[model samples]
Target chain A: MTFKLFSEHLLIVVAAEVLALAVGLPLGVLCYFSPKARKPILWVVDVLQTIPALALLGIIMVLAGAGKQTVIIGIALYSLLPIVQNTNLGLLQVDPGVKEAACGMGMGRMYRLIHVEFPLAFPVVFTGVRIAAVNAVGSAVFAAFVGGGGIGTAIYKAIRIQNMNMLMQGTATLMAIAIALDLSMGWVEARIKRGHSSMKKAPARRN
Target chain B: MIKFEHVSKKFGKKQVLDDMNFEIPDGQFVVLIGLSGCGKTTTLKMINRLIEPDEGRIYIDGKDIEKVDKVELRRQIGYVIQQIGLFPNMTVAENICVVPKLLKYDKESRDRIVHEMLDMVNMPYDEYAHKYPSEMSGGQQQRIGVLRAFAASPPIVLMDEPFGALDPMTRETLQDEIKKLQKKLNKTIVFVTHDMGEALKLADTIIFMEDGKIVQMAPPETMLENPANDNIRRFLGKHMNDDAVTLTVEDFMRTNIITVDKHRGVRECTERMARTGVDTLLVVDESDKYIGTVSIKDIRLRGKNEKLIEALITDNAKTVRRDGDAHECFDHLLNSGDNYVVVLNNDDTIAGIVTKNSMAKALSDTLWGDER
Candidate 1:
């Protein structure tokens, strides 16, 4: 039963991460290329990140009508801050010399971003992805309150019935998942960092 | 040819280029020289449309650059910068092929270009082709940067202090290489640098600017013989002072001399001579002590059968100590039929060369003070 709940929780986090990346990468790039959009977009995502995960799920449930959809949407929205901010910061920190050379070489906007800028900024962007992934794992626990099935539902029932055994198993399972996800993602981040030895550290981001 | 008609620019309230008017003739290496904020960089960026003028038009080969699509226009012109600007993400070959790739060059052509460009700088294709920029030294990275600019074989190139960040030794080597490449490719190069020594060494014409205005524009020799104002005189300070204070071989020698190892192959020696535009080369021993000189004429006459420059070395050129009397050297140059006299250091290493041109330049500087 615990194993089943862990997989479902993993599924929601993965889906939300995918959704967030798809929407957030371009949004970050848009913010980079268009300075006018940067402030407002960052502000919106910053606001999204500050909302309590349970409160965010409740709000999303009202709009999407309760289910896994609401939980996914809520987690995805909550995770957008790190991804979008990191993308914009990563591109900004790219060596100005390289960017100028790309411009001087006659590369179009998209061509430069794909061929030169994006690759240099990849390590930093991936750091953001890692942060979002880890955060989503924790945020996915809000699934129980919005009627989404996951380990959170088991924990919620354990709390209501005062079942110490079930509560310990559910909490322990969540901790294990979070730790495993963090370590594996951290390993992948290290490999990406090794690949781009010239990359600067990602700018600090606020949760 | 590039012509700027009434080109002007202002950054905020400060005028950066005030109605700058100039023309860069085809195949000429024109260097724009000035202080840091004198609009030299702004002027160079305008040609590539990296910065547009507030009021005026820039014409490339008689067409207004404003009318051309910037991306299309930039692809046709090459550019190099002070920061080396090599894309760290790409391999040496990939970085050099950036422009060609953008132009949709076929795979074969791109590979050929990568090989040819690396070969031109003596970087073998098979070895350096896949190495990333971070793996190479600063000098090598800048060399790749230069090759990237010239990859598409653009007819015009703009260099903004391209060697500024390199060490003095590396800067000198890259300067020689760039001047040779500019001549070999017959490209019109507009270079910007604050170093007058560099400007005089590589420029066919030097344009001196101050306060967003052209202070003077002339050949290196003309600028040396006749500076426009006190600013130029100050800019030419140490160089002028060298002529005025002491009449010695050190004061009159051209230190930008080219030398070849005594054991170098005849073909390599001749190639070096051709690249540096010198008819003779000072051959140095294994310890870098001067042995003698080799002339192109002797190479043509008797070097046909010889494989190494060692066998072709001749004592026809006279050698003088670095501290030797300047007037005596001048007299020897005038009376002796030798083309140049080699100036040597105390340890018997070659210091520089004193030819008729340098002697004449020193003489002119003596006759005409920096005032006029």
Candidate 2:
């Protein structure tokens, strides 16, 4: 029964994160190219972050009605800040010398953006996604507030009936899931960092 | 061939390229040099149309650059930047083949070019081909950066202070390598730099710019001999090598001296020394190219009627070319404390020797010619 509850929680987190990444990536890239759009888009996402996660889900429930869709949409909206900010930051932070070199080599703008700029920026951008994923796992427990089943159901029930045994079981399982998600993402981050360092020859020597 | 006619460009209020007009002919190694922000780099960018002119036009091979596609134009011309920015993600071979791959060359040809370019710089393909940029030292990476530009075998190449980041020793080695490669490839190269030493060493023609205008465009030796104005004189600096007075090995070399075969007997060598009234006899092989020298003192000490002249040869021969810069040869002669230095033709055959007598003759000729 505890295993089933953790799996439901994992599914909700994964669903919300995938949705956030898909929507946030293009929006971030758009902000990257069009500075005019960047300010307003980032402002809206900032406002979204300020709202309490439960309040934001409650507000989302008014439109979509309470269910897994409401929970998924709330978690995804909350995850947008990190994904968008990182995507823009990563794109902007690519070494200017590398960009100049690509231009001098006769690479067209589109080709350079896709092949050169994006790949160089991928690791920094991925960091944002990792942060969002970990945050989503923590927030997904709120799904039980709207009757979207997960480990939150077990915890809320244990608390109401005053059963310390069930409360510890649910709490312990949630911590384990968070640790597992954090550790796995950390491993992915390490892999990207390794690839990043190996890709460059030593920094150019200066006179 | 590149011709820029009355081109002008302004960045904000500053005129970066002003009425730049010149023609660089085919297969010439031209160097553009000036202070920072003086538009030497701007002129190079105009050729590839990276920075379009505000007015006038540029022509490449009788065709207007404005009419050609920018991507197509750049693909045909090679470019190198000051930073030697080799992509870290790529292997040495992959970086070199970027251009050729873009041009849609077959796999075999691209691979062959990768090996050929690496071999030109003494970097073996088996060792360097698969190594990442991060795996190599800065000098090695810059060498590959240079080789990448030459990979596609473009007709023209432009370099903007490509070796500027390297130490003096590495910069010099790369400079020599570039000179050799340019000669071997016969490609027209336009290199930009702030370094006067590099300009003098590599350029067939040096275009000196100031205030977004070319102050003078002349060969290195000519520019050194005659600066067009005070600004040019100041810009050339007070480098010890170049001055108003020109001197070469040809100006102080003696053609009349003893010549003897290595097979010739010591008695014959001694006779030639006496006949020429000289202390030394140049010994030559069958090719008539100098191999060593025999001295009167040596002949006296080891003289034998049956022994060949080669036996007395001390292997003390030192050679300098007729067209070699005089100051360097003069210092070599002074430091060695030797009275004679063999002057050789380009083919390495002995032309004559530069000795104290020849220096005296040169002094006399300059003195007498001026008075007359």
TM-scores, one per candidate: 0.79, 0.84
Report how far residue B202 has shifted in candidate 2, in Å.
Answer: 0.8
Least well predicted 10-residue stretch by lDDT in candidate 1 chain A: A198-207
Clashing pairs in 1: none
Q: Per-prediction DockQ scores? A: 0.31, 0.53
Error of 1 at B202 (Å): 0.5
Error of 1 at B147 (Å): 0.8
What is the C-alpha local distance difference test score of each model? Answer: 0.89, 0.86
Write candidate 2's Cα lDDT for B59-142 as tens digits.
999999899988878878988887777776668888898788878999999999998998899998899999988888778888
Q: Can you write out model 2's per-residue Cα lDDT over A1-207, one digit (the tens) per residue? A: 377788888889989989999999988898898999999999999999999988998989999998888999999999999999999998897777677767777878777788778887888888998899888877888999997888888998999999999999888888888888889988998898798878753556564
> What residue runs in model 1 are displaced by over 4 Å at the alpha carbon?
A198-207, B241-372
Clashes of each: 0, 4
Cα error, candidate 2, residue A177 (Å) = 1.5
